[model samples]
Target: MPRTLAERTAAFPEPFSRVRGLRELSNGVVLLTDWIEEKVFAVDFGKGSATPIGRVGSGPREFRLPGRLVPLPGDSTLLNDVGNARLSVIGPDLAIHRSIPAQRPGAAYSMSPRGVDAAGRFYFEIPPWSQGPAAPKGDSVDIVRWNPRGNAIEGVGRVKGSDRPSWQREGKPRLTPGIPMVMFGSADGWAVLPEGRVLIVRSGDYRIDCLAGGASIGAGPPYAYPQLPVTDADKADAVATFLQDSPMSGRGPNGGLGHSPAASKEEVAAMVKTNEFATHHPYFRAGGVCRPRKASSGWSGRFSAARHRCSMCSTERAGWCAKCRCRWGGGWLGSGGALSTR
Candidate 1:
């Protein structure tokens, strides 16, 4: 049974400042990545304490701004250190076994490292968003499989075609070039399931897709939740949340970046007035596939409405199950994606 939020349970010695990712290891040990701390910690709920796993320096075993920590099949862990632009593989003993550069010399990183499958493959994208010099010419894929041993990435598949924005509806109004819009559930809502199947929610229509073996095998039914109309207050709240949570929002007190401490009043107000949120309000949910079968209805659970933080359970909230042990990627709130335990 899922514990109620009011239930007094095991709490870490100190609250986490900002959690970037979570992975459950065997023997009930939970691996967590703290963005603010720039390090990984192994928390043993049974013992009610967290032990720091790696250093926060730029050295071999250190991580700068980490992305996600994926617990692999053989008790190894894949860590995405985005600030340092490297992927460090940590062994069971909490040691860095190997580190791979995340970005290639000439290639751009579309999506940051999201997940690693059982086959030792890392999943992300090279979409070529409009803002960069390597912007795509109206063509780019959203999923790629990177093999660490070979030091290469293979295209897995693209997001569903219908998910693309429809500029035609508004006669293609002229907008600023390079302004970025995110994919389904933002960039964090994607996850690679066991057996190498990839699942992503389609933001355009709130549909979930299952891609595997280099093709999409199925898309889940539409969300049961009604799409709420966005209001000025809603927009303001969304923008404020972004400014508060985004790691790259802007310069910090230290003249550096990475989720700066509460922005100054003037800065926050300025950003709210000037910056624009996506016109097509970002739609997200807590969901995932229960199995890797090719049936159109292979997925379970309906998309639920999300507030500031989406903590919906794709399946029953029974801690970690066999299928979602890694949970490498997640949505904005670290809890938006399909959930199933079958």
Candidate 2:
């Protein structure tokens, strides 16, 4: 079982609305992004308090929905302001050094996380729809690399596997959320290694690939999927779990038993039949966990190298960091409890 290091009631300068991403540095400083507040907070574990890195706005140093914080050398880091369609470089003092637009102004292309290679070339992923009329000609697409010192962006490595949606493959129109439609074996996440190789993490299947230039140099350990299909017992158990987790279960809008006080077995069975696979197997893992206040008040998380190969750090859980090598435990900041590393 995982153990706790330190636990306390953390009162930040302000309450966090929604924590999108977090990273712990080698110096014992924690950085977190609040999706709702649209700013990053740097907390000192020794101080037991938090400070906002930058104001929340659409200006140069401001952020919209800051999701991921990638730390660079010399205490500088990159903030992925996904909602703003830009990346901001944060200095050691938590000041915005500069901002890099993810796409051409008014362009519709969606960019992936900004990763830095050993040579310091920043990479961006262009999903198919965002590629527009001049999108790549094949199913496999490449990641773009931008040199910060100069003004040039070039295609470097390819996104290992294809991520075409399941609805498209089944010849059906998509009406539900786009995430569940993403095929299981498709590429989902990628990170640039310390040696400049790109590490790609897939979802459709559990696999990690290390790529150089545009080819695979090697791969990490393989993760086998659950070969068994969804059984009736599994369906019932899933429904039970959902109901037990639902806050509105057994209560109506007026807080009283309404037309249907409880879910019927038949209704649950129908729901299972409709959403068994999607509900059980979420699109992808967020790669971190958050512990409850009773156990650990402050943020405690792990770090991952490529698809959660947690060998570099000492923690029993898995997370990702560019500068830290500490083995921390916890989940994604807003997960409410510890997240599973595997």
Candidate 3:
């Protein structure tokens, strides 16, 4: 059975030694990490003090904002770049080696990538954000599997087609905890299980979705149909329908409910249908200083201006809604508005 939060904490190697950071290498050595203030530390089974690796990021070259790190074959380390959009390889000393850049930003969610393969090939993943803020409307994402050896990333499958592995019993830790199959964002990205099944998690009605890819597979829903008329009421209905199964409402880390409008309307419909939404609870993953307990307190104000604390504190971000942030399809709203020092 998967250990509960308390159980996992109790089983820590040492008391008072909380798990602050975590990353799994391609070699299967999961880094039990801790970041005290600004410094970083990770441990091995030897109980040696965690090495102070330089920094982490999700950019192409630098660790700009490393979401996760995987130990590549031959002592090489690949850092998933959240900022620069690339896979950065670093040496034992934490020096930059080579980087595999993403074809587009927003495509790969550097936060979670499966890792490199046997023959020096890297099977990375991109979320729905691959399409820049402005692209042809209705354009969704396609999982691009990058092969550094060949300097190419072929489309392995669409966001919804890569899930056979996630569903099989092969990927879960056979002996230990019971973490359900969640390939990145429910079924929104790439996941290759230990069984070698490459399954896609999709968003809408399966029949309407057109699965597309190379030898691999991808899926897309039909854009215009009798059921989806281009009327204001229909649009509202569609958006309301969109909210029902959006990843933003899930209970994953930081509230699990993070929204990505990159998927086109048809894509959105498909994602909901696949039922591959994030499952982590967001309330428990929140990070924020104690809110000044003045001029606010109530469930009603949670969405109102009075309640300023993070609603999804456990998993919620420290910003305003993505729509309110900029013309650029990201949410800048958070504890710190124009100048709150939040």
Candidate 4:
């Protein structure tokens, strides 16, 4: 089975240039925009292969170099264009709807913008300069929000900005600690949680830091999962099911033993006899092959895990069920698509 995953960038039209900005519009469409090239494009995200749906022209007045693509729940979308400080929206067919407009902020950013919340709100900051001696600097680089319906922009909190957007402010200073390799105006470089919470990922450290004021900051607990023997098809279905189940997880369990739904009937029976999965998850009254033969075309290594992260903590085993008691979980074979796992 494939042990890792990666995102492959698809080639665009000749004049299209590199996709500097990308996001998902509600109708399952993938939006791609280019700042240097000045254009916006859309595609079906669920297709076995990517396909562009539409294209539009958005030049200087619209976006100096649009940085990020944000799709709000409504008919609105936000573009991190230079002049405008907040998001801008485009209609279904391809028309600029409502946007705060990135007016010349007394400063121009060579970099493109990257992210925004589903709420149509986001933030940006100034940076230090290169080719000239300067320290990281900017206005009180802060986070703010915008409401499409109301067409309003409001301040949420401040992110320490520099007097200049030098190598450090860009998280590329020689003295900086770089882990995730986030550059200014990068996507997935900044993210909004499913809960509408904002967390800033330091491009250098890969350490996630919450942006909203009074937010908590800490690394999650070290977790591990078991690996199972299965074909690519079963693994694929399991990934889809798992993702469907956990709406906001970035990475899945670290494939491990018992964690794989590929366990044999006898192995499963023995596991259930010990009440392994049932102990952690109260909902898991039993454990066994909910189905196995049909696992190829319609197969999903199905196992039920007790709700792990909840308000109340129980003695129940959590995660991949390596050693915790009563671990509850589910899985599938590569029945869906092998690429889905990565």
Candidate 5:
């Protein structure tokens, strides 16, 4: 018989309304981003203290809707200020050092920083579609690499995006209504290793594809997991969770990227419950890829809706390495090389 590993939970003095990002700093502190609170915190788990970094504003030392925290060289970290449409760098002293525009000069679009490489190149995803009159023109999204030193951007690879169901009014040709619920949506997951290698996890076939220097290196063997059927209980739980965390209702003072006015709880619940659900869950969920460090294997953890658990798999040298099980939630690689989930 094999022994199962026990799970450990880290407790903070105060609870976080919504935590979107986590990164281990060079000085053994964990940096956290609270999207709903619109703040950044430096949490020292060993000392059991979380210190707020800055205030909520659009000024040099302030930020709005602080999103992902990307670790950069030295003891600095790159923060995505989604509301302010820029990136801020925090030094080892936990102070804002500088800010950079999220969008390049004359570029039609701005992107969030997805990953950073050893050579200081940044990676971003250009979605295949946008809301309103422009719909998905294709099935794949492009991954671009940006070298800030030369202000150069180049297409490195392409990955498939999710295909969720939507609706449109009978007489409104220009209006594309949003889907209230997508029960078994599938989308591609990707991450960039510090060594400049990109790994894409395909949800359709549950396979891993590898790219290096803008060229295809190889692909890993597909993991054969059963697509369990959805149940009534699952549908009820999904709706309840969505209602509790809906952006329309939960957006703070920043107003949430220009969404419609907040919908009443009852109205939102009714709208979500009316949407049709899939019979079975997709192979894997999107946005679940974990960033890998240099000389380490890449990990992709997919939350299985049917099983109510997470299925974690690793890729090494573009080949399948191992598989494991864990609780369903976002996680990060700790300094001691352990996986910590919340």
Candidate 6:
């Protein structure tokens, strides 16, 4: 049985402007990335200090808009440098060991890394919603497996694309009105286990499906959860939170990446007035699934749609285990069951 533990805070010397990624290394050093600041830092929580890992630039040793931090074998970590369009390996000594291109040779789209295996092969997903001529057209997206040694990219599995409310108007597609710009709708989630198996969380039926080498191995029983209705308060809250946390720059009106200013107060108020919401929350949160390094269990943190703070649940080879709620970000789980947040 999973029980709640006493909470404690590891305060840093300076407050981060915006923390996008956080991961605890084997040596107890926490590596964090500040997206808005476009920098990465190595923080010693016991010493109450932080040191910048790499400079902020497009150079080899530097990175711009450092995003997800994926833990690799041999005490090393993989940093997704979104702005530089590459992945960098942070060595055990806290130095840049090498970098890998985000896009493979002769590939049309860049790779969005999700997890890494023990043998150092990367599992990534190409953006299904990629715009313009190269955008993939389909209701499903491919989960690609890439081997760094041989530079081979293969399709390992397929999953559903994002579910957004849109319709055709004037012979063109347009977003549906009354829909909150951001809502916790049903969508699929996936993560790579330490043993190189992929776990896909199907939201439609609330089930866990396992895959290895592009083949379905097994599946757990479906989780029976209530469909909680969305209320007026939920719509208002979602809009407020979205505006508050959104970046001041580098976002387009349709919620894609571009150079546009943040939405104005009037625009937000209009959205709230016309915003529609789903009747129920998704069975599992999207982009919230991750497995701890060297652990048999996989964990999903937080239930934003249900308004449950710090709630976590685990899925193993057998089935799902609902754990006690605890305060922490939805990052990697420690071996001893400690939740490391971002």
Which candidate number maximizes TM-score? Answer: 5
C-alpha lDDT values of all predictions: 0.53, 0.53, 0.35, 0.36, 0.65, 0.66
Tens digits of lDDT, candidate 5, 103-156? 888676777777888888898886544333443344566788899999998887
lDDT (C-alpha) at residue 202 in model 5: 75
Provide TM-scores for the models: 0.67, 0.59, 0.38, 0.40, 0.78, 0.77
Residue-level lDDT tens digits of model 3 in 79-132: 554344466666655456677664434343443445454455555544443445
lDDT of 1 by residue, 109-172 (tens): 5235656677777776665542376433343445778887887768877653222334422336
Look at candidate 1 and give me any clashing residue pairs: 188-330, 287-337, 287-338, 287-339, 288-338, 288-339, 314-339, 315-339
What ranking emerges by lDDT with the best candidate at the front? 6, 5, 1, 2, 4, 3
Against the correct fold, how does model 3 do in TM-score? 0.38
Candidates by TM-score, descending order: 5, 6, 1, 2, 4, 3
The deviation in Å at residue 231 for candidate 6 is: 5.0
Candidate 4's residue-wise lDDT over 44-163, tens digit each?
Answer: 534533444223223322543344554444535556553234356666655566555454334344322333444544443333342134332342344445454675655544444312
Which numbered prediction scores highest in lDDT against the true structure?
Answer: 6
Once fitted onto the true fold, the runs of candidate 6 whose alpha carbons sit more than 4 angstroms away are 1-14, 129-138, 168-171, 175-182, 228-260, 271-277, 304-328, 338-342
Candidate 5 vs. true structure, TM-score = 0.78
Worst 10 residues of 3 by lDDT: 293-302
Runs in model 3 deviating more than 4 A are 1-21, 24-29, 32-40, 45-48, 55-62, 83-86, 91-113, 125-140, 161-189, 193-197, 200-342
Q: Which ten residues in a row have the lowest lDDT in candidate 5?
A: 313-322
lDDT of 5: 0.65
